[model samples]
Target: MDQRTDRPLSPYRHFSRADWARLREDTPMTLTQEEVTRLRSQHDRLDMAEVEDIYLPLSRLLSMYVAATQRLYRAQQKFLGTGDAKMPYIIGVAGSVAVGKSTTARVLQALLARWPNVPRVDLVTTDGFLFPNAVLERENLMERKGFPESYDISALLRFLSDVKAGRRPVTAPIYSHLVYDVMPNHRVEVDRPDILIVEGLNVLQAGRPPRDGSAVPFVSDFFDFSVYIDADEPVLREWYVDRFLRLRGTAFSDPKSYFHRYAKLSDKEAIDTATSIWERINLVNLTDNILPTRQRAGLILKKGANHLVSDVALRRL
Candidate 1:
């Protein structure tokens, strides 16, 4: 089926799950079931079928975009007579917390890297750019951890700037989910990869521009393509609570974990605590910051209560 619709003013043309799958059209499957299991998040289930139906089409589309971009870059160099390195093809993946953003990013990375051209792919999360817990506590922003204010946005922007400039060996901070803090002196380096997938809650967010209209670079500025994982607020809350409960038995049980105290909580207490955190922190952040930027993405994956993507929306060019 074609993507054309009668509603000309609508920016997006919607696609049913089955219609989207048809776009895959003879694209070879590169992922094994075991590989998909490794790429999925603990709270997200991604099977081989989902990979074939949703991600293979996406991978095919991205490959075409990347190839076209590369060709344009080569043409530009011939016209300008400059030998500068080609910049990385940046893809931004954004969503509310626990909406399976990580799973989507990881799966895309795996699938894209397996393309026949053997393009190098790297995944970076905005978590590493978040302010340290100590800094958050000192600034009294610990309670608003995922809010836009809690990030060192300047650093994140600078990192994206360097990557787009074809900078060599750019480094970003490393964060420990176990300690709930940025690690001391730990870093992940991005060294001129062919493709870089940036995944985060607020990667697609923008800030107020100056009244004079001077340039202000946002994280999404460098992206060649952007994807937003979407679900209803209630579904997101349920997924978040389920993830919290699962972590309580695993990561939270570690003595060194920042949330170790939560391990011994009774199920009722866990539910109450999880719901409280959701209401205070995640829900507020989602409403105030994340959901507002959903339309900015080139692609949106609308998920069902089952946490699998049920519909896809593409912004018409």
Candidate 2:
């Protein structure tokens, strides 16, 4: 047997998050105490320390990737001797629901946007690419909301392709967390962004073969870099439940919120419902689809039970 198979996986070999304070030196911390406090109110346990530690270094790393991508684009432009406009440095952020993927995307967008050369950053979530409620209902897959089948895969692929091909002003549907659905009339337009961060639960999923056996490209194929946020299954479950309860008090209270039904549930009932949703949908998707794609990421952030990133896994160049 291989010795590697016998030993437990080494976390630090990925990227140790233990001494994050020190590694944060290169990244800027511009948020005021009030700003951080407000953000923390929404993200409760997060603080300036966590931002300085995990996100700071992460921002620095992404800056490097963005710079390199720009250089590559310029070099290709020079070689081709054509007037092709430079495309955005596209990043794919992937993880299970409630795994902090949205937070990661937002933070990265904020940090990357500050870089001198890449000031225009756009963040797009795959939630908008999900099939409409009516379609899902007709397909009898309302419960499979975040599953791969729930998406308009071809549309998502074309959108990424157009953005990567330097198309001007690509529009993607907007998903309202309050409504827990995509609003047909509301769409976000990304017009020649310097950096485009595409975040979703399954962005790293592999492409399926065409029924006619032709090759097909996946959404991830257009990414210059990718991130996978990971945590223990139980920790993730707890986070999901905790976030649900918090939203129950906040967004779920909105009369138009699709999850308003959940807001009325008692604490124990809410916990049971959260756990059931995890077991039935999110957890199954994570194991069957998301976790297997971790190795495909350029970097992976592993979180501990405390919801703080404990390790970073960067693919060996």
Among the numbered candidates, top lDDT falls to 1
Off by over 4 Å in 2: 1-13, 19-23, 37-44, 211-216
User: What's the TM-score of each model vs. the native?
Assistant: 0.97, 0.91
lDDT of 1 by residue, 1-317 (tens): 54565645668888889999999999999888888889998989788888998999999999999999999999999999999999999999999999999999999999999998899999999999999998999999999987888999989988988899988999999989999999989999999999999999999989875578565558898899999999999999999999999999999999999999999999999999999999999999999999999999999999999977899998888
Off by over 4 Å in 1: 2-8, 210-215
Backbone clashes in model 1, listed as residue pairs: none
Q: How accurate is candidate 2 locally (lDDT)?
A: 0.82
For residues 1-317, write the lDDT of model 2, one tens digit per residue. 12235546643235466554466666678666665555443643666777888888878877777778778988998999977877888899998777788777877777677776647999999999999999999999998889899999999988998898878879999988777788989999999898899999889998665787553567888898899988889988888899888888899888988888888899999999999999999899998988898888888888888877877777656
lDDT of 1: 0.93
Model 1, residue 135: what's the lDDT? Answer: 95
